[model samples]
Target chain A: MSKAEIKSPLPGMFYRRPSPDSAPFKNDGDSVSAADVIGVVEVMKSFHEVTAGIDGKAIRFLVDDADAVMAGQALAEVEA
Target chain B: MVVRVLNPGLSTTVQDLGRPGYFHLGIPIGGAMDRLALRAANLIVGNDEGAAGLEAVFVGPQLEFTRDALIAVTGADMPIKLDGEEKPSWTALKVRAGQVLSFGFLQTGARIYIAIAGGIDVPLALGSRSTYPIGALGGFKGRAIAKDDELPVGNAAGGREGRSIPEALRRRPGMPAELRVLPGLYWHRVTEETHRNFFDDQWKVAPEADRMGYRFRGGRPLQFVERDQPFGAGSDPSNIVDSCYPYGSIQVPGGTEPIILHRDAVSGGGYFMVGTVVSADMDLIGQLQPNTPTRFVKVDMDGALKARADRAALLDRIRSVFA
Candidate 1:
């Protein structure tokens, strides 16, 4: 299996779940399809979803939940 | 041509230069928060300087073109994509029918301006297409656009595709901004110590900011000079006889936080205004993001006019590029 990395498109605070009370979009080892939302980046109080472009099994997230991330920073690794 | 709104990200509204000469009638001069960006977008698409366009805040909208048309996105560093392919901003590009134009996470700044070859064809109110949602007047049905709203496009003026603005002309985000203010009208209400604090200290933008006004927080609370309340002036120290408010007026209620009224602010209010943001720097206010630190620089009328002239010269230089 080839590994792929999902990168953040913009700089913001990364979140594993949609909100504070919600479950994470995907857990480690979970399977995801193309276009499946993996996380969200909150900027200027607006939230934008980060989606997977390739189907794969979720690996570990590169950043912790609520950590500040920069544009093009790798968020998570996926095993295709 | 027609454009369909697939997703109205945040508050997307159609705005132009705005209608002047109507403030006396109790109508606010609601228009584009960043007029410089709006003009740049229009210039890229070969439209009039004041042509109507979409002002997307923080997030941008998902727009599907119904026909082939030329478009340009300016202001804010929000990444834009067409048909799922990333595209550059501050440049004109051609879009085919059924192509979806969407945005990525905001990189910097707060709003993005999207201009088509032909401006958004909406019924003009008071000689402008700008939206004033408080009064529910002008723009697309006088409100922010909704998903699935089909907006008609006017005739294209024919601008060259692939035209890009010079790098120096673009306003980079994340840079500290200094907005020039002309202190006047009720300036005497605040104590001298507060006046010094207002100019010397950095003020952080509060989250309560919006199209109506940008409220800032920082420094010691300003105190008004004790005086007997005049007739029709409320008891609050910040309150005065309800009067006309010029665009960019800064009013402090309870003297705790200062609110700089913007393009869509109310025409008249009882709040005490200590200063008016100069016309040239109003665009800078639009680019300010929440929690960003800013400083108000005091400038005289001559300085303000000079700044305005300098901006005009810069715009002229940009126009020469396209000409």
Candidate 2:
């Protein structure tokens, strides 16, 4: 088994869900594949998708939802 | 020549120097938010200083060149890639037909400018090719670009590739920008404490900022001098009789948040303007990102003129680099 960390490409507010009223894109123990949108980083009022680059089972998020993230910050961990 | 938009990331629009002399007709001088970057992009590609180019916010668009072209990217530190290979910004580069250009995440600044040789060949409106999205006036169909849109490019005017801007001229992100302002037109209405605080405290740019204006928070709530409400004036303490809003006017709607109007702002409004951002620092406002700390510095008319002269000199220095 191997684990990989998802990183944010830009500095902004990280959101687990697509919107405030919607369910999160992925959760702990959920399966994801490369290019599966795991979250979004909202910056300059623009929303950019944060995609999972490796096929894996979601482990746990490293940062809380709606937290401010820096460029290249680790967002979540997944087990492959 | 033509370039096809593959992915219109965020908001991408074509703009030039902008149309002036039409505010009397309620037309805003909609153009590139950062004129300095626009000029840099054009100069790198051997185009006129006011040549039309694409302005991308945050993320940049992916485009496929249909013919050999020379291009330069400027402003923000958004990473550029040609067919997945990294490319340097602020430098002119040659692109072959069928080659795709894409952008990675923005590393610094909030906007990026892409200038191709001979500029983007869109029909001009009102003596300028700048886009006025509110009224759908100019640029490509008078709106932000969409995927699959094929933009016409003009014939190259002898632009050379590999020319780069010196590092000293580039704007570094997170550097606290000191913007010079000329106080006037209802500035006396605010309490002295609030006026002092405006220049003394650090203000963070609000997330709602855009081309129209850059709003600021984290500053002390400004206090207005008590006065009888004039007829037609709104009940808000910050309301004023309808008046013209000059470009870069800083208005406080409710005395809590201050919005500095930009190139795309309305010509007039009914808000109390505390100060006008000097023209020399207008480009700095375009680079401001959400949550960035900014400080306003008060300057007199003489100081403002001096700043403008200093900026012109800097631009000349850059122009002389390739001359």
Candidate 3:
């Protein structure tokens, strides 16, 4: 297995969950597929989905929820 | 010429100088966030200063032109692309009948203005093509452009290619952008400490910044001066009897985060405003990237008028030079 990083295409506050009250799009340590939504980056009030680009497992969140992130910043890591 | 939206990108809408005289009716001006940039793009392409153009944020739209046309891209530092070839921004370029126009990722600012030889031919609602999306009024059926949507372009108005706006005429966000503010009538509501700290702190533009308003964070929470809860004013210390919100008014909803209402500002709101950003500095706010640092500089009536005159002079310069 190998580790891969998921990066955000847009600069904004990264969110683990779709909404404050909802469960996260993907849980920490969950197995993920290439197109699985891991989080969202809210840019200037608009939410854009961030997806895992590779099949992986044991996903570990790198950035905390609601933390400001720059473009191309790594959001999470996954074991492939 | 009609252009087909091949990919509508993030958020692209048609806008002009905006519809005024309707703010009292709860319709905001709702034009391009950066009016100067919009005008520059239009001017560079030989269109009317108030011509309707495409305003894209973060990303740029891909459009295939059905007929030859001249175009100009301005505002953000995004590289323009025509049929996959790189083109310079703020310079008028010609696109063949089949050429597709696109843009690269934003390098500095947040919005880009795309002006064609002729203006976007969307029907005007209440005298303008600016989109007021919240109200479902004006511009390309009153919403953001969508993929596969065919946008009508006005007849060509004899714009020449290769015309460009000079570098000095372009406006960009500053290193720690400064916004001049005029304390509003409600400035008396906040404590003395808040008055000093509000201007003292360097605030960051929150992720929630948008056309409606720009929110700021990392500022100290405010303390309101004790006062009897006037009738109709809510219980929250920051709440006031709903009052007309002036464009650029800085409202503290819960005495915490400050939101500066912009072009699409609501006509009335319950929050208390500490001050309003001077009109001259308002356009630059639209170019600020999220998380960018900003400082509020206090200004009085004389200063505000002087700044307005200076801004108008700059606009006049752009007009004359382009003309």
| TM-score top scorer | 2
* Candidate 3 chain B weakest lDDT stretch, 10 residues: B102-111
Which of the numbered candidates is closest to the native, going by highest lDDT? 3
Candidate 2 wrongly placed segments (more than 4 Å): A7-11, A17-29, A33-37, A40-54, A70-73, B171-174
Docking class of 2: acceptable
Chain A: TM-score in each candidate?
0.93, 0.94, 0.95
lDDT of each residue in B131-190, candidate 1, tens digit only: 998788999999999999999899998898899898899854344568899998799988
Rank order by DockQ, top first? Answer: 3, 2, 1
| Candidate 3 per-residue C-alpha lDDT over B34-91 given as tens digits, one digit per residue, 9 for 90 to 100 | 9999999999888899999999877789999999999999998887899889999889
**lDDT for every model?**
0.87, 0.89, 0.90
True contacts kept of 3: 0.56
Question: Which stretches in model 1 have alpha-carbon errors above 4 Å?
Answer: A1-80, B172-174
In candidate 3, position A79 carries an lDDT of 97
Instruction: Assess candidate 2 and give its lDDT.
Output: 0.89
Native contact recovery (fnat) for each candidate is: 0.09, 0.34, 0.56
In model 3, which regions exceed 4 Å deviation?
A1-7, A17-34, A53-64, A72-80
- In Å, residue B266's CA in model 3 sits off its true spot by 0.9
Q: Highest DockQ: give the candidate number.
A: 3
